[model samples]
Target: MSQPVIALFTDFGVSDPYVGQMHARLVAEAPQARIVDLHHYAPAFSPGPAGLLLEALVPHLTPGSVVVGVVDPGVGTARGSLALATDEHWFVGPDNGLFASVLEAREGRCFRLREPEGDGLSVSFHGRDLFGPAAAALARGDRMVLGEEVAEPVRAEARRDAVLYVDHYGNLMTGLVPPEDGGARLRVEGRNIPFARTFGEVGPGELFWYRNSLDRVEIAAREGSAAKRLGAGTGTAVAWIGGV
Candidate 1:
């Protein structure tokens, strides 16, 4: 049998120890599972945009892999935990609209993560204490940790006409899919960005939008940062220029 895969996606920046603790917990509970770091910088404290970005990533992952998502800002609150079982992957995370895009992508079974009877888990770090362990258990084919089935998770708050993420290179990834025509343009931050097949298609230091690897519209500036150029970031409103 193929090895079990547990991919990690979070807004926990690398400068902190939060992600490391999750890795430690996963390794301890699911040693047989291989861990993949999908991403660690996903628009801090913004799960709606992160969920949209994650939805774009679902098709690229290996079948039946487990994804541990920790973009939760309401970690210690009354907000609940969720386990989303899709045909292509399993997602474990908070119920704060993190899995909304994924849930809307297809039919899936949702389960509430059961709480531990003891008070050992940390309130502020559910990523390591709750989600990590749940992912490990799911990786090991154990669903006992999941509680009741959830009929409807929160709806995705990330709109397709908005910027979902801004990468380190300043590329702006939007939830909107690009059209086949290279002539199609996108408007954001009161600026119009033309389409290009790639960075080389445009002159150096030029700004353009293209269908990114993840099949989403990405705005980039060759030899420069698009975010800086357009003064845009997550939640920036994006609009179609030519009805595409």
Candidate 2:
């Protein structure tokens, strides 16, 4: 039989034993399961970034994989653990509103869970006791349920109509749209803004926003950090007032 594949995504950096212990627990439960690390460096509790990375990596993972994502900032809160079933794979994690909207967007199947036989359910470390062993059991060909289906989750909206992610060079990377055949207009923080294809198009040292290769509006300075100037980062709301 083919070894079951389990993908681990967590904010637990390699500097600690938390991640390792989870792996050990999983292996102890399901010996034939193949464990793969999707990533261990998720920005602490920054599920938005974690979700974005998870979505981007989805295409590259093998089919029929069980992906365990534990970016739980509210670990011991009333938040519950979940197991999502998609046409291709299973995604398990805390349902403290982390990427639930994104998961629903992909038509995933969700299940609410309880502990399995011989599994100790610990609220403080569900990733190890709950997620790890459950994934292992599923890998061992055991049928299990983790959560129930629900309506789509609510998502954050861009204040204007775009967001900004800082680039390696510290560019604000806004979401303002470019001018059309006539002219393009955008809005930000309730104020209208103009678009520039290049930094030079804007006055020297002045801030401007424009669409880039990804087509999302980006905020940038003529030769500086629009982020530093605007005091914003990814998820900073901006609106595409008008563009063609």
Candidate 3:
């Protein structure tokens, strides 16, 4: 059998030791696995928007990969940890709606993670102490250790008309999918942004909307920051206009 690929998605930024510690644990636990740093700055502490971004990103991941997602705002409390087996990938994370869109789009089985038996599992750092190890185990094909299967996992309402993420270039990636026909426009913050094939199609610093590689409608400003130009950020409302 081919070795499983492990993808890490989290709100733990690169500057901190949290991500490094998770990487170290995965290395120790699942030495043979290939780890992919999918995203580290996933709209901090907000799983609903994070889940939408994950859903848009799912198509770009390697098939059969194991995704370790952590966007838990209620980590140390009574919230549960989960392991989800989708049709083509396995996702390990907190059951705080981070995997909601993934579950909604794919056929999957959800399991509550079994707590660590004797290890020093920290209350605040479950991403390193708990989820990372569980993801590694899943990547190594050890399903038995993930605890009882749950019938339903928590789900957040998928928002289709909201900006899910803002890229480094300040492009606003909305949850709404692009229209099938070409000439669609996006209305945001009282501005009607026209559609463009690419950046060059519009004048520099001009705001426009396009279908991103992920097939989501994205608002961008050619050679500029759309987020600033439109005064928008994550969770900002966007409306579609004039498309077939």
Q: Judge candidate 1 at residue 25 and give its lDDT.
A: 88
lDDT, residue 222, model 1: 99
Each model's lDDT = 0.89, 0.68, 0.89
For residues 71-105, could you state the per-residue lDDT of candidate 3 as single tens digits? 99998899988998888888899998999888888
Q: Give the TM-score comparing model 2 with the true structure, all chains together.
A: 0.65
TM-score of each: 0.96, 0.65, 0.96
lDDT of 1 at 152: 77
Off by over 4 Å in 3: 242-244
How would you encode candidate 1's per-residue C-alpha lDDT over 49-145 as one tens digit per residue? 8889998998888777899998988888899899999877899999989999888879899999987669868989998889889999989988899
| lDDT head-to-head 1 vs 2, winner | 1
Deviation from native of the Cα of residue 222 in model 3, angstroms:
0.7
Cα misplacement distance, residue 173 of candidate 3 (Å)? 0.7
- How many Å off is the CA of 132 in candidate 1? 0.8
User: Which segments of model 1 are wrong by more than 4 Å?
Assistant: none
> Candidates 1 and 2: which is better by TM-score?
1
